[model samples]
Target: MFSLLPLGYVGVMTADAGWDTIEKLVFRPRVGELLFNTVALVVVTVPICVVLGIGGAWLVERTRLRAHKVWAVLLAAPLAIPAFVNSYAWVSAIPSLGGLFGGVLISVLSYFPLVYIPVAAVLSRMDPALEQSGSALGLGPWRVFFRVVLPQLRLAAAGGALLVSLHLLAEYGAFAMIAFDTFTTAIYDQFRSTFNGAAANMLASVLVLLCLLLLLGESKARGNARYARVGAGAQANPSRLALGGFQAPAQLGLAALSVLALGVPLFHVGRWLVAGGAEIWTRDALATSLLQTLGYGLAGALVTTILAFPLAFLVIRHPGPVSKLLEGANYISSSMPGIVVALALVTITIHYVPGVYQTAVVLVAAYALLFMPRALVNLRAGLAQAPRELDEAAQALGKPPLVAFFKVTLRLTAPAAAGGAALVFLGIVNELTATLLLAPNGTRTLATEFWTLSSEIDYTGAAPYALLMILLSAPMTYLLFAQSKKVAGQ
Candidate 1:
């Protein structure tokens, strides 16, 4: 029920607005323009991200790329810098960077790693037998990769593409900074211009539908395919293909990616920090924002992890229609833009539960809903590691059912739970749209504070917050990459 609040909010808002009002708001030139911008952004960006992700992953994991280990980490390092920070850097460098092209450029640089990390994880664990058989059949390396290898990557690619699409939909700061208008940006504009206005709700309604379509598209793209070996002696390391003449090109591509994605943000942030000098660091608000950001990130992570455990356990321990239904609810809920989730909570609390409106509880709950999937995915994996047989054995050894579950199953999931919590922490710390909408008066997170200063064109003033946010996110980003490798049985 809680998970469905976002859908319900849109439904209720649309109903309240009536068909005429909704039509006026949604079926207009402005809405059409925003839709085109949003769709074009996804269509142009996701494929490039997929290509880059797969190629980069293949090079790092399956080919003789120089400093493969270093490249692996470097490719994923861009994720430590928030998308908006990347936008800030680009806009600072080239103020003319805007519109669809700029949106695509910044988004690809910032988000390709989303695709890379997962596809790389999948590639690292791929069975070389498929490729070997293809080679035996006289297929060249490129042919084997295209025909045999790439098909297997469909699931990962589809998932990564879905993530990229959703990020584009949810993103506001990046596009906003680049002067590109998407559904999220337009929705934010609507809300700011007219708080709880009919048009804003209607725009959110359309955005929600768009999200549902992407979900369905991803479902179709991802088909029901399982890749598990029936019996295995041991997993063998996939043989690395020598790059020969392709070496320099691959290295150059990766180097360029590193420079654009990781380099720009670091350089610009450092420059601003230097310009800001002692004035930025000495600001009391900087320390306050850091502490508040940590406080909120920690709180949100704890809440989300706790909330995710039951759903993950239910799906893992006892898979059934009910569990699947609940799981689907969560995935759909989490896939919605943070703006929609924040709007839903804002509407619900302001109209129904006035006491908690704009409180930390509301903000935390929003974080949990928006990031629960991170926790669920990890907890499900961890739960699978423990197995039902262990719980039965623990109970057989004279322990109560509940005690057995706690001592055995729950204990084993601790590390995964912590990892998921860390991801949730990362998400909340960098989140912008939702924080702007839902945070109470006087609340100041690093993301919110950075946004505040950056909005005023004070990139120098925003420098410390950007630097601190990157610093805070770096470890979590590395953890995310390392965890993916570990999960692939590296």
Candidate 2:
């Protein structure tokens, strides 16, 4: 059903008015400009995100920096601030920061943590023996990293880059805030200003193509590389590099990154709060939006988590062509822009279930479809760790298969399941496009509300919602950091 969304998109493309729409939109210089802007942003931002993520991870995990733990948390904390919120902060602080440069800067700052967490986890769990071998062969630290450590980091880094690319492709709010014309923002504009969804759908088709190319590129980059160690001996802590004279510079760099990524948004939010100019912070609006955001977030998280379990179990336990295909389908569907999913649901619901059209049920379903992969990935990781042998062992102890699964596998995977649910919840809270389309009358999420007010140049009115969004996402940010540490055994 989730996969059907893309098929619906195909139907949209081939409908009666489709070819002419595609030809006109495709040949337009505006379409070419949007493509260039989108590709250029990804081309620049992905590399920057990779470097920052890997660099921050290495500094925190492999350096003798003071208060490494604090630094680690600080680096990961930016995940709480949405890219749109970051854009709002920068553009608000400096009104001229409203173009391609600002878009790239805000996106990189907002998303580098996606790279940092996975890379840091891999770094923490890596066998130090490899590094030791490199050192014994007379390789300097830089040479050892380039030859040994970096090869091991290839899979994680590539995976992070793919994620960054998908996000850049689907991102509408941030780029829209900065007046940068990307496919996503253009799609939203096409839908909003002219109600010309055919053109928007064509733009989305281009985005879908970009997403497919990225997935293929990442898979090729990953190749058949195996990162696990061969030795059976217990692993020991890796040695930290002495920063020496570079320590001050490293500290300053980290400080600047944190300020840019995290501090700026918070500072602007605080400023707005103190100025007391927000017209939308009334009791009814605030209470209603908060409840709606929480309600949708919780419902979406729960549904996505439930749906992900069986799929994760199938992929991890029964690794085969079918399982791999199913997993790939999930990835493709999840990578789709929210507008695509929203249009798909809108088409289906309005046609088949007219009573539920534009209802909260449809909106929550969109959230589940868009975010199920977040839950699936974490659940797969947890299931992989919980081994089938544990379930068999429980069965050997006279428990039934179902009972054993619940008693052993589910219990062991609980933390991962919770983490996945938390991630989905945060995603739902921050989701803008789908909510804008599917939310019934009188429903208002913080994301949609913020976008509405900010679009009207009412930054002060948007501040409370933005701050609430950050506060709501903060615990999940901490949860992600703690979970990564647990995975790395740090």
lDDT of each: 0.92, 0.87
Q: Please give, for residues 1-490, the per-residue lDDT of candidate 2 as tens digits.
A: 5665765565556475556767887779988999899999999999999999999999998889888889999999998998899898998899888677888899999999989998999898888898999999999999999999999899989988998998898888888887888988888788887664677767777777888899899999999968886655456788999999989999999999999998899999888877755454774787889998999999999999998898899999999998888878877888888887887787677668999998878888888888988899889889988999999998999999999999999998998899999999989988998888789998888998899888998878888999999999999889877787776553
Q: What's model 2's lDDT at 331?
A: 78
Residue 336 lDDT, candidate 1, scale 0-100: 93
Error of 1 at 120 (Å): 0.7
Per-structure clash totals for the candidates: 0, 0
- Please, what are the lDDT tens digits per residue for candidate 1 over residues 1-490? 9999999898888888887897788889999999999999999999999999999999999998889999999999999999999999999999999999999999999999999998999888888788889999999999999998888788888989999999999999999988899999988998999997888888899899999999999998888887654555246788899999999999998999899998888999999999988888988998899999999999999999999999898999899999999999999999999999999998899888999999999999999999999999999999999999999999999999999989999899999999999999999989999999999999998999999999999999999999999999999999999999888763
What range of 10 consecutive residues in model 1 has the weakest lDDT sum? 226-235
My TM-score estimates for the predictions, one after another, are: 0.98, 0.94
CA RMSD of all predictions: 1.3, 2.1
Candidate with best TM-score: 1
Residue 127's C-alpha lDDT in candidate 2? 87
